[model samples]
Every structure is written in C-alpha cells, then in structure tokens.
Target: MRLVHVVTLVSEDGAYGGPTSVATGQLEECATRGHEVTLLSLWRGGSRAPAHIGSVPLRTRPARALLPGRFTGIMHPLLVGDMWRSMGRADVVHIHAGRDLVSLTALAVATLRRKRFFTQTHGMVEPRHRLVARLFDRLYVPLLRRARGCLVLTERERRAVSEVIGPQGPPLLTLPNGVRPEHDAEVERGPRAPEVLFMARLHPRKRPDAFVETAALVHRKLPGVRFTLHGADEGELPTVRRLIAAHRLWGVVSYGGALSYAEALRAQARAAVYVLPSVDEPFPMTVIEALSAGTPVVCTDTCGMADELARRGAAVVTDGSPRAMADAVCEVLTDENRRAGLVRAGRRAVAESFSIHAVADRLEEIYRNL
Candidate 1:
C-alpha cells in the first residue's frame, strides 16, 4: 500500500503532545510494515527539518499564505494544484490536521484528482469560529463529501459532524487514539501512598483550578497525600498559580512542566490516582495512557473516554465537578482492594485494546477498504 500523510507539522521530540505522538506512531508503523509512505509537511524555509525517519519519502513545501501571522490559514490555488499532482501517485491520502491550509489544500486536491482521501478530524473547528474560517468551511464541505471516509476521534464528534453536514457528510468512522504501553515488565511495587496527578494543558476548559481545589479538599482528610500537575500552560496557568500560592500548597502541590512520553509514563507509573478533571474533551489519549500505566483514573463522565473507561473497568467516572472528581479519587485511593482491581483491569485493557499494534491492525483494514 502506498500512503501519503499530510500534516502541517510533525514534532519529533514528542513535545507537541498526544495527537502528534499518535500520528507519528501510526505512520511509522505503516512504514515498518513494508508499505510505501510519504510525508508532505509545511516547512518554513529557515526551520530545521527532522533528521531522520527511515524508509519514508518526505516532501516539504513552504506554506502559501500565513494568517494570524504565524499560522497557515489558506493555501494558494496554484499550490492546491501541485498537491493534487503529488497525490496522483499515491494509493491513499491521509490528512491529519483538517483545519490547516495544507489540509484544506489536500481536500481540494483529493476531490479534483478523484483520489482516495481520509481525514482525521481532531476536533470540530473550535466551536467559536472567525467569519473567514466559517466561509472556508462552507466552501470545503463539498470536498469533504467526496472523501472516501471521514475519521472522527470520538463518537460524539462523529455524531455532531454528521448533523452539520447531513446527507453530504462523508461515511463517518470513529477510531480512538492508540498509545504504546509504558511498562514492558512488572514495575517494582512500593507502599501505595495516595497521590493525585493531573496532566494536561492548563487551558480554561481543562479546569486546572478545580483540580487544585479538589486536591486541597482531599488533603484535608488524607494529610500526607500530594498532587502533581503537569503540562505546559495554555492560558489558565496564572490563575492556577495564584490559587496554589494562596493556599500555601507550595510543598504539597508541585507543577511539573511538559514532559516527553517516557517521562509522562514514569509519572503515571508512580501515581495512585490519575485525574483528568476536564470540563470537556475529545477522546483524550492521556486518559488511555494513564490506564496503560496501570493507574486508576478519576475523570468526568462527560468526556469522550467515560464510556470506554467504564468498559475498561479502570476508572471511576463522575459528574464534571471538582467535588465529584475528588470524591472518586478518594474512593479508589482509600480502598486497597479497589485500587488493586483497577490496576489489574487497566493493564488488561491496554494490552487488549489501546496498544499501538492492535490499533494499527484496525487502521490497515480501513486503508484496505479505502
């Protein structure tokens, strides 16, 4: 199979978080399986190119139009023609980031070429959109309808997109992100002291403040317990820092900066309870990674992972409230039998469902069908 993966950016250090990691993992696996793969990405002329990716051919082109100053918004019409010519040689064209100019160009190119195109919509165009963005989408809807299939990261997103596009909505397929298992062998067990960990961007919707307040509440009863926060700030860091300082939780609550995939796994391996504490999310890969690390998770029932968590039997899902999250974490951490059961279930879930190779098999089937 010959496949072309089109994304505006690819982070090699695993610094950009889950979506990048998932795409890289899947593309690399496809390359390893003796399939021909090509990567077309926007390369800002002065920026450094990735040093290596074995056996995969790559093409880098300068983005035609830069909008919001630094971001790629719309591609030049001529560039879309160039992209179409490139896709003419491939069996499949997979667009990873659908909001970018490269993606829009790919969609247009795929339609004109009558090529097999598949799109992975990370999240539906951030609910509130600029007028220009909406205009672009209106123009692109027809192209989306012509796609071989549309891939949605979560079931909710699939349903929402179906409603928006109606009969013209391309055949929707929901595939959850895949994660590699962190621990190959049994990790050394230590005396489990209950500690809560929150790992996500400090964005408004992530509700990091709620996580902190919940941690304070949990600390009142479990005096020795600690909470560790990870991930780079998006905008809510200042508020979270203020709350942490005012509470004099400088010692009990620590902020660990964004980490590599290995570092995140190490943190998850040490945690007694992993808390997502998100107000809303679209199929978080972190929740799956925490489960893969054999840690019990406490997350909102409103998120994409809620149903999966219940089915996996690795987490306690409650309402999207700090108090609810705290209570769930406390319940799991305080009971040895319950925690142990969750750990066992979580490991089994990852091995059976979320493993990279396991997901790649499903993806291969999709590619064949396309």
Candidate 2:
C-alpha cells in the first residue's frame, strides 16, 4: 500500500510536540510493514529536513511567517505541490491536521484531488467562539466532511470536533496514541535518580512555570531532590525562568533545553518520577512515554488520559496545582512501594492498551476499508 502522511511542522528539536512524534511513529510502523510511506511536512529551523525515517521517504518545504501571529500566518510556499503529488499517489492519506495554514492547505488539496484521506487532529481542531477559530472552521470543516473518518483522542475531543464539523460529518473514531516500550526493558531498575522530570513544550498550556513552583515546594520538603525540565520554548520559557529565579531554585531546578524524541525517553528512564502540570491535555504523549519508560507518572486529573490512568493506577493524577503536584512528587519520592507500584502498572497499561503494534493493526484495517 502507498501511504502518505502529512503534518504541519517539523522543527530542529521537535518543538511542535506530539502530532509530529505520533505521525512519525505511525509512518515508521507502516514503513516496516512493507508499505511505501511518504511523510510530507513544513520544516522550521534554518536546517535541512532529514532524508528519511527508516525506509519511509520525507519531503519538506521551508516555512516562513509572512504575516502576523508566528504560526497562524506562517506559509510553506512549495508544500502544496508536494501534497498534490504524494497525496494524489497515495492509497490512503493520513493528515495530522490542525487549523493552521499547512494543515488547511493539505486538506484542501487532498479534497480537491478526490483522494481517500483521513484526519487526526490531535485535539487541535475544536469548536471555539474566537474569530480566528471561527474563520478557520468555515474554511476547513466542509473539507473534513469528505474524509473517510476523523480520529480523536478522547470523548471530550470527539464532542468538540462533532460541533465543529456538524451532524453530516464523517465517522469519528477514538484512537489511542501508540508507543514502543521495547527499550524500556533494558533500563536498570534498582533505584532511579532523585529527579523529578517534566518534558513537553514550554507553552502556557503546558505549565512549565508550575513545574518550577513544584520544584521549589518539593525542595523545601526533600532538599536532595532535583527537578529537571526538557522542552522547546513556546513563549513560556521566560515565565518559567522568572519563577525559578524568584523561587531561588537556580541549581535545584535545571532547565535543559529541547531534546530529540530518543533523548526524552532516556531522560525519563533515569528519573524517579515524571510530572506534567498541564491541564486539559488530550492524551499527552509525554505522560505515556514516561509510563513506557518505567517512570512513575504524575499528571493533572483533567488530561484526556487521566481517568484511565488513575483507574489503572498507572499514574498519580493531580489537580494542575503546584501544591498538589509537589505533594504527589513528594509521595512518589518518599515511598518506595508506591513508586514501584506505579511503575509496574504504568508499563503494563501501556503494553496492554497503548502498544504501537496494536495501533498499526487498527490503522491498517482502516486504510484497507478506505
């Protein structure tokens, strides 16, 4: 099968976060299955796009912000041609779409060419009363109705997308983000380092500041405990730095810059606990990656995966507050038994429910049906 996957942006250090990671994982899995996979995307950072991922081919066009709002007005001039060629030749096109120009253009070309395509928005496309969101919806929602199906992460997301695309929209399917945990088996698991880790983009929604605050609070209780944050900046690093400085936690809370996907897993492997203070996150890939890495996970109760993770005892769900998060971190740090329980349950939950092989199997079925 010839499969084409499209995503909005590819940065030097994966600043765009989960959508890019998820798409790459899916396409690589497809490539290993003997499918001719092509990944088309807009490249940021002044460097060249990589040649390929495993056996899959990659095509990228440089992105430039020619107008207002860095991402909203960014344009990838030559990407439409790439989209036309790859999506036109594809047996199925899977677009990791958003309301941005790149994704909207991909949808337009795919629809205009009458290609068999599916869209997975990664909680990006949702109903909003904002003027920009309203405008973007008017442009893309009709195109979405022509899709074979739309994939969502949670029931909340499904409902939001439904409102955006309306009653006549395509079937909405809930698909879990898949992960590969084979490398986790190799981790030395006697006692992890006394480190609390947060890995995600440092955006306002991600709450990197909260991580710093949590670090401050945890330090008061457990002075030996260290906190590390690794993520690309999305206008929130300044706030995080300020909070760290204000709290006088310069060395205790180190800010490691953005990291590659492999590097993130390695960081998780060494950490005593992984914490994400972000709220309303729709199945945060980082939390699941932490789980797969055998790091006891701590995330907010409002994330899409919170209920299942809490029910399975796979993670400690918090209330998106530094105090709650710090308490959770402290508990995981002080109690060896509880920490071990979380690690065991987290790895089990990921293998049984969020394995990449199972996700690929479902994707294959969907492509065949299309």
Candidate 3:
C-alpha cells in the first residue's frame, strides 16, 4: 500500500508537536511493514526537514496554505500544485487536519479523483475552538463524513467528534499513539536541582501561562524547588517570558527552548517529575515519554492520557488551575515512595501499552482493513 499523509507540518520543522509526532509514528509503522509511505506537508518557515521517518519518504513544499478562517500549521499557497501531484501518486491520501486550506484542497481533489482517503481526528473538531471556527466546522463536517475512515487517538476525541456527526460519522478507527523507549539502559531518575520539567511547546493552548503561575505558587511554599520549561519559542514565548520576568520567576524557572528528542530525554532523566499544563490536550505523547523514562507525571485532569496514567499509577491529575497544578507538582516532587512506585508502574505501562512494536501490530491491522 502506498500511503500519503497530508499534514500541516512535518517533523523536519522545529515545531514537531503531537500531530507531527503521531504522523511520524504511524508512517514508521506502515513503512516497517513494507508499505510505501510519503508525507506531504506545507512548508512554512524552517531551516530544514528531518531525514526520514523510519522507512517513509517525506516531501515538503512552500506554499500559501492558510485562508481567512483556519489556523493550519502549513499555509503555503505555492504548494497546491505539489499537493495535487502528490495526491495523484498516493494509493490512500490520509488527511490529518481539516481546518487548513491545503486540507480543503486535498478534500476537493480526493473527491474529484474518486480516491480512497482517511482523516485522523487529532481533536480538531473540539468545543474549545473559537466560535467562528466552530461555525466553520459546521460546514466542514460533511466533507469529513465522506472520508473512507477516521482515525481517533483517544475515546474522548471520538466522543467529541461523534456528537457532531452522530450516526453519520465516517468509519471510526481508534488508534492511540505509540512510544519507542528512549532509554536503553536503566537510568535511575534522581532528584536534580530542577526537580520538575515541562517539556512541551510554549504556546497559549499548551497553557504555558499556567505553568508560570503554578511555578510561582509552588515557589512560595517550596522555595528551593526548581522548574525547567523546554520546547520551541513559538508566538507565545514572548508572553511566557514577559510573565516570568514580571512575576520575578527568573531564578526559579529556566527556559530551555526546543531541545531535540535525545536532549529532551536527558532533561527528563534528570528531573523527578514531569508537568504538562496543556489546556486542551487530547493525549500527550510527552506523558508517555516521561513514564517510559521512569519519571512520574503531574498533569491536568482534563488530559486524555491522564486516565491511562491514573490506571498505571504513574501520574497525579489535578484540576485545571495553577494552584492545583502547583500542589500536584509539589506532591510528586516530595513523595519518594509514591514517586518510586509510579516510576516502576510507568515503565511497565509503557512496555505493555505504548511500545512501538505493540502499536505497530495494531496499526498494521487497520491498514489492511483500510
């Protein structure tokens, strides 16, 4: 099977967030099973792209991809020609997000060409989006309903999307994200200077402000505790920096902008607790990475992965507030026995539920059906 992934961004760009990461994982699974795979993304501003994801071929083009109503990762208009050409070559065009202009272009092309296509619901059609965007989604829902199948990362996302489409929903397939354990050797997680780490993009939706506020609250009680925020400086970095400076959190918190996976793992290995304060995360891959690294997680109750983490005894889920998050982090940082238990359970959870090989076998079954 020759599969083409239509997404806003590819991993080559520094903004390799959840969607790109998930796509890369899926592509790897497909390719390793001997399926010909290619990723087509609208190239925005990035110095370069990664070499390849497992065995999949990756191609990105610069184009004007955004229109008036969408917040697409790739909004390059110059790439329409390339998108059409790529679609022509693919056996199945897997569309990742629908709000983007390039995605709309792909939707139209897939219809015109009578091609088989699938769309992965990365929680785009959620209630959290803007009113105007939600209204636009009313118009966009039918196009998605026409797809051959829809891949959902979590049951929460599936339910949210199903509410809108109801019985008319496309063929739904639930596939969770997989993790390839970063640490080969058993590296014990020790209490370092920075006891907690936030290893995700510094964006508004990620609720980096909450992280800043929580860190301040945590510092008030635990004066010696340290927090490190890592990931790329997107548009929200300035605001986060401003908040940190205004609140005088300079000494307590260190801003480590966008480290590579290896660098992120090094940071994760040192920290005792991993904190993700994202406001609307469907499922956080970082939580799994943290668990796989034997680091306990302190995340929001609203997180989809929090349920899984709870079952694994690898995380403490708090209310979606700075104070609550602060308390959770403090608890995770101080409780040695709980931390040790979570670390052991977290590693086991990763091995059983999120291992790459386990996830690959599941995805291969879906590919065969598709």
Q: lDDT: which candidate is best?
A: 2
Query: Which residue pairs of candidate 2 clash?
Result: none
Model 2 alpha-carbon miss at residue 2, Å: 0.7
What are the models' TM-scores?
0.84, 0.95, 0.85
Ranking by lDDT: 2, 3, 1
Please give, for residues 248-308, the per-residue lDDT of candidate 1 as tens digits: 8887888887765567777777888989888658877888878877789888887887887
Query: Per-prediction count of colliding residue pairs?
Result: 0, 0, 14
- On TM-score, the leading prediction is 2
What would the per-residue lDDT of candidate 3 be over residues 1-97, giving only the tens digit for each residue?
7888877765432365777777777787778778888887755454655556556677876645345532453466556666777778778888886
- After superposition, candidate 3 runs with Cα above 4 Å error: 11-13, 63-70, 127-139, 182-193, 232-239, 260-262
Q: Comparing candidate 2 with candidate 3, which one achieves the higher TM-score?
A: 2
What is the per-residue lDDT of model 2 for residues 1-370, given as tens digits with 9 covering 90 to 100? 9999998877787777899889988888888889989899878775677877545677988888866765666777788888888877888989998878887888899988888999999998877898877877788889888899999989999998998899999999878898877857655555678999999888888889889989999999999999998988888888988888899998899889998766777888899889898878998888878888888999999999999999999999988899999999999998989988998999899899888888899999888876
Q: Provide the overall lDDT of each model, using Cα atoms, as 2-decimal numbers.
A: 0.73, 0.86, 0.75
Evaluation by TM-score, superior candidate among 1 and 2: 2
Q: Give per-residue lDDT, candidate 3, residue 17.
A: 71
- Backbone collision tally, model 3: 14
Q: Is candidate 2 or candidate 3 better by lDDT?
A: 2
